[model samples]
Target chain A: MAGKRGGNLNWFYLLLTVVVLTGVGLMVYGQVGRGKTRAGKASMAPVNLAAMAEPDLIKAARGVNRGAESARVEVMVFSDYQCPACAYFATNIEPQIVKEFVETGKIRLIAQDFPLGGSHIYGFLAARAARCAEDQGKFWEYHHQLLALQNAWAYSRVPPVETFQSYAVDLGLDAAKFNGCLNSDAHADLVTANYQLGQQAGVTGTPTVFIDGRQSLGPNDWDVLKAEIERALGL
Target chain B: MTAAPADHAPGPPANRMGIALLALIGLMIAGYMAAYMLGLLGAIICGTGGCETVQQSPWAVFLGIPVPFLGVVGYGVMLGTALLGLQPRFLADRRIAAVLLAGAVAGFGFSAYLTWLEAAVIHAWCRWCLASAGIATLLLGCAIPEVKKLRRS
Candidate 1:
């Protein structure tokens, strides 16, 4: 009787193992397939253009401005350095926009900080770090560095102040001044001010953008952003 | 639940079964987190908490592999060892006891480190992660005496 029971248990074990392996394999394959399709199609999360209200720029604060002042289309961007979508925009799309629209004297780009608070532990500190770099007139360089190395420090088990300082040192900024600025909360108010600006504009997420201070766009894909810019330029 | 082989030092089969049960519980918790990491699950039902924040953090991955995946592997090994040790043929084998004990120790240490990270570094608590750590500690407790009995023989 014991022998017969063991024989039956062996079949059960083998069947269970096979089922578990097959289920896990299919789930992984499906996720990978969907990820590839999304990337290949360049499809982005949709935004409701009609629901986007014009943010009151007059009451909101702004950050560093890039491009020609005479540019007719002013693109105001609210972003968080620790946000993945915002990182994608900064790393992949923003440079292209700069080359085409900003350089061509068609648009002025303004960057505003919007740390998502509890969701991103390092977002506000990262914003302050960027502003500290701005003290040496290297805000854009530091901003790019932050997004590029986001994976390195964003989930760190320690406060990433030293890593932020290293970026400043690499950018040839005064290390002591940068460290002092970061540690002393020199730019904390500026970051807070920008956060308030985002809130007052009804911004609920990172990477939110407004064109000509009237039209809002969650520009996740370059094609969509470019088309919107071209339309704004009457192209 | 068969009787221990006569040559063995008579470690209770119940302890081995308990270890296996704890390991299975740990595996389920870790597997759920792994599913979330893989994007198969939309959101963790952590109830207005920091599960998303903690799981999305950099510490959630270790050397390019997701930490929860590592948890799944660790618990799976422990479960396998415990099940095999329970078999009549393997009851006398000290190697099975050693492997289960080693796995439990490793899991406990890793879970403790993650718990510390949540409290001190990430400043957020993931209930699933906390539960896994608790289970790992229990597994370690169950394995120690079994290994000791095996060693005495």
Candidate 2:
């Protein structure tokens, strides 16, 4: 009886060993895959710009934009700087969208601000910081940096204005001008207007997205957004 | 605690193996977070949307190292001692039990502190961090039996 019990225990050990080894193998594999993707995203390839006719919606939107203005489909994203889901959309999904549709001239992407003022302490400030970066024609660059490095300043105890300025400096923006703009809240009204516009559009939380003037896809689901974009393009 | 009596047998093999397995799981959780911290991973897919917030908070780091990396080290030690305790040559040794108990106590205390920080201070909870805390608690529970057996012996 004791011998049988030992044999069963040995089998259990063998199974556990296999499971643990497999788990480790999978983790290492995942890390390698993620490393390659991170490298690909690190380059921040420039977007292809085309000066097509600006649509009325593009003219009405109060935020930064990319892609040909005449692109058949419009994607307007209402996002907050401190929101994680928005960060995911910016870091993971937006690149693919920019590569596939924006560069290809099939879609125009506009990012509007919707800082959840009550919840995220620095959301409004981060939005203002991005606008300051925009003053130097580096809105997209500074925008991506803010989302990608959200963790660095999102929950900081003190205001992250210096960190915001440092990011501008890193992007090779005119440090003196960017600092002046940020310190004076040069774009406070613009950010506020965008927030009011988002509220008017019935957006309660970020990152609420509208494709071709119709609300679409929850945050972080790239495949769904891709399909919606395709359907809008009638492709 | 005094040195374990020389005549004491090592912990039951089942308990040692259990501890080892749990530590391995804890290591994986911490390893994932550490990788995320280092930017090897893209995003943390969490339901509550608080994982990144908690991780990004100033409290996420202790000293100069990320907290999860410290978790990786602690769990690694637990795993090593548990596996070593399973070896036949070490089966009669009590030092492994002592090390495991010490590690478990430290881990449990640290996990509790982090959990409190999540609730009381950070006001955000990362499920992965919570899961790590759960694993640390389990490690403490698993280590207790062996140490108790050593004490009685």
Put down candidate 1 lDDT per residue, A64-183, tens digits, no spaces.
Answer: 999998999888888888776577678888999899999899999998898887647788899999999998999999999998888888777777899999999999999999998899
Per-residue error for B112 in candidate 2, Å, reads: 4.3
DockQ result, candidate 1: 0.14
Q: Give residue B105's error in model 1 in angstroms.
A: 1.2
Least well predicted 10-residue stretch by lDDT in candidate 1 chain A: A1-10
Model 1 alpha-carbon miss at residue A117, Å = 3.6
Clashing pairs in 2: none
Off by over 4 Å in 1: A1-58, A63-78, A82-110, A118-122, A132-137, A149-190, A200-235, B1-12, B38-58, B86-88
Candidate 2 TM-score versus the reference: 0.57
Whole-structure CA lDDT of model 2: 0.78
Encode model 1's per-residue lDDT on B40-83: one tens digit a residue.
Answer: 65312111256765786678999899999998899888888877
Instruction: For candidate 1, give the docking quality class from DockQ.
Output: incorrect
RMSD of each: 7.3, 9.4
Which has the greatest lDDT?
A: 2
Alpha carbon deviation, residue A199, candidate 2 (Å): 4.7
